[model samples]
Every structure is written in structure tokens, then in C-alpha cells.
Target: MKVYDVEGFPNPARVRIALAEKGATDKVEFIPVDVMGGEHRTDAFKAKNPDAVVPCLELDDGSHISQCTAITEYIDGTFDGPLLTGKTPQERARISMMNLRAESGLLNAVGDYFHHATPGLGPDLETDQCAEWGNKRKDVATRTMAYLDSVLDENDFLAGDTFSMADITAFAGLAFADFAQIDIPANLTNLSAWRAKVSARPSVSG
Candidate 1:
């Protein structure tokens, strides 16, 4: 397998963490796709993923898998390692719900505010910015942080007791939030403590 991604970016980081968690990082090749250099926009790259996104997983047989969660799911399911998604139906549902909330409520909101309000990925890639909409989404992202803090107050992990993809996604979201100048409020102690725990994980640097 070949993984195409840029280092340090949020989505790619999510995939990398998943790969590490599945113990599959050594089984694949890492291909750096330079988003800032517009490498992802090329026709050749587009052939693999029309969406022109990074963190794409290309199988040995030339099959392509896009979307971070889908790629993570594939890796977790295929590899013989710790499961990040879930083992049972109930667990899957809970993890998936928390995962979506982390993605949409925090990750996507931070991304929207960065791309729409601020100049994200440089001027060439950020053409249609809507400051008004972006501002609203920024507020949403902040609010979501507070909500997540409350959630963390109840449990160690986002989905349940074990570390899962929801935790990984939220970790990536918080990193993205930092890049977007969206700081987690100082009062959100639970969220901060959770971030500390997740950051210390070995998979985070994968």
C-alpha cells in the first residue's frame, strides 16, 4: 500500500495515527503530496482521487481509498492490531456517533473557518472566502469544544473507556484548531486533560 499525504496536516495526521494504531505503518509506503505546492491538483493525482485530497490510500493492486475515516476503518479492519473503530454493533454505533460529532462539530468547523475566513493553503487554493460564514463556524467550533469538554468530564475517552478513532479525530481537530488560531478555553479542564493524554500517545507522532 501507498499512503499519499502531507506531514503535520490534520486529516493526514488522523490517517497516520490510525495506521500506527493498526500496526500497518511499516507495511506501506509513505508518499508526500505537497498541497502547498499544488501537487494534489495535478491530473495524475486526480486520477487516483478526484476530490484531490491527501491521506489517500492506494492498495498494491491499484485500488484507491479516500476519506480519512474510511481509510482508517479499512486499516483497522484489515490489519492484525488493536481495533480503533469498534468490535460490536453497539460499540460501533457509539464510536461512529462520537466520531461524526468530532469531525463535523469541531474539525469541519475549524477547517471551514480557516479556509473561508482566513487564507488557508495560501491564496491560490483559497479563492472563495466568506468571512461572515466563517466567523459563524468559528463560534460553532468554540462551542463544540465546550461540549466536548463536558463529554470528557463523563468519560476518559470520547466513545467509551478504550481509545478509539473518535479520540484520534478529536485530537486532530484540536491540532487544526491551533493552526486556525482557535484556542481551547482555559476553563475546559477536562478537554485539556484529555488532550494531554492523547498527545502523549505513541500513535500521535506516527
Candidate 2:
């Protein structure tokens, strides 16, 4: 199996963390896709993912998986190691819901803000063009994370006590927010501790 990969990006990092959790990192081939240079938009890469996104996976069987969440789900089902997707119906539902919340709320918002506001990564829009949107997005991202932190405070993981895909999703968003200079407040200690734990994992460094 091969992983369409990147560095200095949160989505790829999420897949790497799932790989570590499943003990599958050494089993798969890593194919780096350069995102900073817009390599993902090249014709060759568009052939794999028409939208030209990073962190896609090409299975050994010739099937391909796109999207960070889908790739992690494939890893969970395809391997026999630790499961992040959850084992029971209720667990699956809870984790899936929370994962969606994190993806749509914290992750996407911060990414949108960063793409339009951060230097050296975007098209350099006029300040009047994206400034308000960026500021609002940053605010929403932080508020969403605070809400997520409260959820974590009540449970060891996002959905429940068991470590599941929701934790992976949230961690990716939080880490990405850090890169965008948006972070959960220090008062969100539960979320901070969880982030620390995930950061310590060897896969996260990738």
C-alpha cells in the first residue's frame, strides 16, 4: 500500500497518527506530495485526486482512497491493530458525529482563515477582501475548540472514554490551528493534555 503524503500539513499528520495507532506505518510505502509548491494541482496528481488534495492513499490492490477521514477509516478496517473508528454501533455513531463537528467546525474554519490570511501559503488577497472573514473564522474556530474541550473534559476521548477517530480528528484540527496561530485557550486544560499525549506519539512527528 502507498500513502499520498505531505509534510507541514495537518491532514497528512492525521493519517500518520492513525498509521501509528494501527501499527501500519512500516507496512505502507510513503509517497510524498509537495503541497507548498502547488504540486498537488499538477496534472499527474490530478489524475489521482481531481481536486488535487494531499494525503490520499493508493492501496496495494490498486484502489485509491481520498480524504483524511476516509483514509483513516480504511486503515482501521484493513488492519488488525488498534481501532480508531470504534467497535460498537453507539460508539461509531458518537465518534462519527463528533468527528464531523470537528472537521466542519474547527478544522475547516481555521483552514479557510489561514488560506486567506497566512503569508507564503495563499494567493495574497487584499486585506479588505478576506480580513473580516479571516477574523470571524478564527473566532469561531477557537470557540468551537472550547466547546470541544468541554466535551473532552467529561470523557477521556471525544465520544467516550475509548480512544477513537474523533480524537484523531480533533487533534488534527487543534494542531492545524496552532500552525495558523489560533489555539485553544490555556483554560482548556483537558484539551491541552490530550493534545500533549497525541503530540508525544511518534507518528505525529511525521
Q: Evaluated with lDDT, which candidate comes out highest? A: 1
Tens-digit lDDT track of model 1 for 71-177: 99999989998889999999999999999999999999999999999988778988889989999999999999999999999999999899999999999999999
List candidate 1 segments past 4 Å from native. Answer: none
Tens-digit lDDT track of model 2 for 1-206: 99887865788888888988888888899998877677887998888888688888997778788998888899999888877888889878888899899988898888878876666274533233476677788888988888888897788788888777888888889888888888679898988988887677665754
Give the root-mean-square deviation of each candidate in angstroms.
Answer: 1.0, 2.4
Model 1: per-residue Cα lDDT at residue 103: 97
Clashing pairs in 1: none
Estimate candidate 2's alpha-carbon lDDT, on a 0 to 1 scale. Answer: 0.82
Worst 10 residues of 1 by lDDT: 197-206
* Residue 23 accuracy (lDDT) in model 1: 76
Flag clash pairs in model 2.
none
